[model samples]
Target: MSAQRKLSSIGGGQKTHQFVDDSNRFEELMRLGHSDVQIRVVKYGEESSGRRPLVILNSIDFPMPPSEQFCDRMWRARFRVVFIERPGFGTSTPLPGVLLQSETIRNGAASMAEAAILQEVFRRLALEDFVLLGMGSANSVCYRLAMICPMVALAIFSNAVFNQNILDVFRPNWFQAMLRQTIQSRAGLQIASFGVKYRLRRNPEGFYGQVLQKSAGDLGYLQNNLADFERGAELFQGIEAQTIEYDLNMSLKPDSLLKDGLFETTNAVAFSGLETTDHWKSQLNQEAKRLSIDVEYAPNGDLYAPYASPEFLLKVITDRLNRLGAAQSG
Candidate 1:
């Protein structure tokens, strides 16, 4: 069952979203086995021109479709962007018994389930070769996909969490640390997730303001691109609290993804902003070295590079694709 509608400006409670350019974007629900996965497909250029496909697994903090402006740039650069609203996020159904079990959440079974669903989704889309782009926590899913799905020709990650242990290096404040420990339990996680959802609904601006304070680059981008930031935040509010709880619990696991050697066979590159915290930079450097993959630092970029430094992101993609082409020809 699939349906399509023209993209248009929408108004939230107190905020008006006007930055999502009026473009030919449509949402479709893909029936995979017993569940339906919602996907937002935005095409930019001519299909007959052989535009490449870019599969975006959005970060947990920003689990929304890309802005029309961002999609337009990808289209102009000959790439079709597909945004997957993962299970329990948008209208998509959560995998059976995956999120309900604490054992699954703590053991990373949820991520493996997501990766399997994504692999099936790619096969149905007939995407034999596509670029996989992941941001933040979604990068774990990307690593898993690249290892299992041969269709992933190139994997690009931005501001990715290297492992669960890296969070320890952040040395969070006492209150933050307490909250993190509290969330280890199911009841505490539910309460925290609900609190976050409430904050996002009632005072998104303040919520995001506090969240981005650690990265000046992201904070400046949020201040400068309020409309764009708010647009994403509006979509962010729609995500289910259960989904947030599952992601948070999974991130706390010591053996999640990279820590278990899942990234060993992935063809990937990681990017971080130059102005990111020393803790993040140090972890990313160590992980990149351990994985033997390349890490590029974007000038004046940060956690919000997708929204703030689109040009730099595009340049990196274009250069990599060109190099791949040259290598194939040679």
Candidate 2:
């Protein structure tokens, strides 16, 4: 790992978060245009010439730490794993003002601008030619990045969200509108932030349990990994709530790519669990058909598998990477 990168508070009077860790995983805040983005980067095993670096873009609201065991597996497989907290989450600076635009065309342009921010992040880090992994709504941005950026050679989506319907189904239109309003209103944002902190603190178990139940994952896992889960939540301290809201709002929009040549320029994979809704599965299959990409299904895992069952998620990614390695060697 590179030398520890120093972090400073972004705005005057804003609270700062200190992230010192024993695992040698470094977290840094870097300026990107008018916003500051937080990135957590870790490398396992030896850096070999044979494998490509892997970048994992987590969900908008989750700044969850990368799975250590999964990272170890990637190392043994010859890949370096990087977990990044997207803007408006963790310690990353959020865009100023209400992000909801007046028109659909303008919303699409905003989505493109967000993808461009990822490109800028790569340039700032001097990173290139890496495989991109995105989970849930984050995959939407990854798809856009892989389509437009030459350095993204492979794009992987796990329990990917491809349409506005997914978000609408998960949370009704009225609820989303309420969230948008709370995120934009200062007093509302503080109250909402306080509610999040209170639940995560007072009922971390019940809190994470509700999340795990969505996929029917084992809640016992959360019990066993309580400390890790708490640590991951700690990373969210002092993060900009508006950024999380921004991504959430953006996620409710349609896919960023034109349907014609979705994954044409990049090798793609969809890793999902058996419990995924039939409608989502059908949509994913259709998108995969369009891109000529296969969906790799894990028998007992679901959308939140990466957090709930890291081993299952790791296997899915490794299987694809192994196939690519074999084909290249042949």
Candidate 3:
């Protein structure tokens, strides 16, 4: 059976498109390049909102920071948000065969396959046009999708990864190699799972603190909004051990989407933090220059700007969408 027909039956059309409780979101499978990738989609807000749907591209860590809160924030602004789970993240199927194959993961083939999957998603959802929101490493995927899927009317980026080489400069060279090997073996998965349990569930605060050190105030903010963290962690529930390995693997790969002039022809908006880690500064600037992206830097924002300054992020998004809508009508 074709993937579209299979998904239609699963969603039952009406049930598939209706607004559901947070816990009742639906997951469907789509065939992409010899692998069956899982995609869980949710439509937020009343259908009558008349706003273009928002499709969010998740990061390398796979839907980082839980999206329930983010979705709520968008929905409240009358935008319907679709949270896409990239292949190898959450319930999605991992790449077929050993993911550690340097040629496949580092060459850009994996990213191309992922972009094809996004194209299929646009067709299956019957999306005529929508806003594209790319978070973290997912920004690369979003950029690739925009190139292939014309249905994406606008693209929004948040702390995106334009050049992996810049990011690699900050990483401990040994750790990257070790992580790749660990994700390719069964025994390694078991060990990684044990580590994830301790970090994500047993002591999430400690885990988050280390990652949010540049945004210490944001970490404290998360402490008060722990529910968002808990929900974001759900994206990695069963796959934490594999997610890091896969994300890093992709990071090492060449990015065709970040090439010069890629975003010049597209309508896009970008946001980053003046307070972000020193490592990301050069990368952000280079990416912005390549596409002529005017980045809106937030004083109190960092990598966690999506969660730390939801109001600011939402305002920028909402205002841009409004402009797009008005332009379409005019």
Give Cα-based local distance difference scores for all models.
0.66, 0.60, 0.61
Task: Give each prediction's root-mean-square deviation over alpha carbons.
Answer: 6.2, 5.6, 5.9
Expressed as tens digits, the lDDT of each residue in 4-35 for candidate 3 is 21224422222133323344233344443333
| Candidates in descending TM-score order | 1, 3, 2
TM-score of 2: 0.73
Candidate 2 on 127-169: residue-level lDDT in tens? Answer: 5777787877687677778778878767778777555255433
Q: Can you tell me which runs of candidate 1 are displaced by over 4 Å? A: 1-21, 34-49, 98-100, 168-182, 220-241, 256-265
What CA RMSD would candidate 2 show?
5.6
Clashing pairs in 3: 65-232, 66-232
Question: Between prediction 1 and prediction 3, which has the larger lDDT?
Answer: 1
Error of 2 at 237 (Å): 5.8
Off by over 4 Å in 2: 1-20, 31-51, 98-106, 167-198, 216-221, 234-241, 256-261, 290-292, 307-330
**Can you write out model 1's per-residue Cα lDDT over 1-330, one digit (the tens) per residue?**
112333332221111112224454455555555434343333333334477888887776666666666777787877877777676664556656645476776677777888898887787666767888887767767777878898988898777766525555432353255357545665776666666667767877777777776667677766765665565666665666566666665554554456444455566788778866777788778877776678888776476666566788788888887887898799
List runs of model 3 lying over 4 Å from the truth. 1-37, 62-69, 98-100, 168-198, 231-237, 240-243, 318-330
lDDT leader: 1
Shift of residue 54 alpha carbon in model 3, Å: 1.7
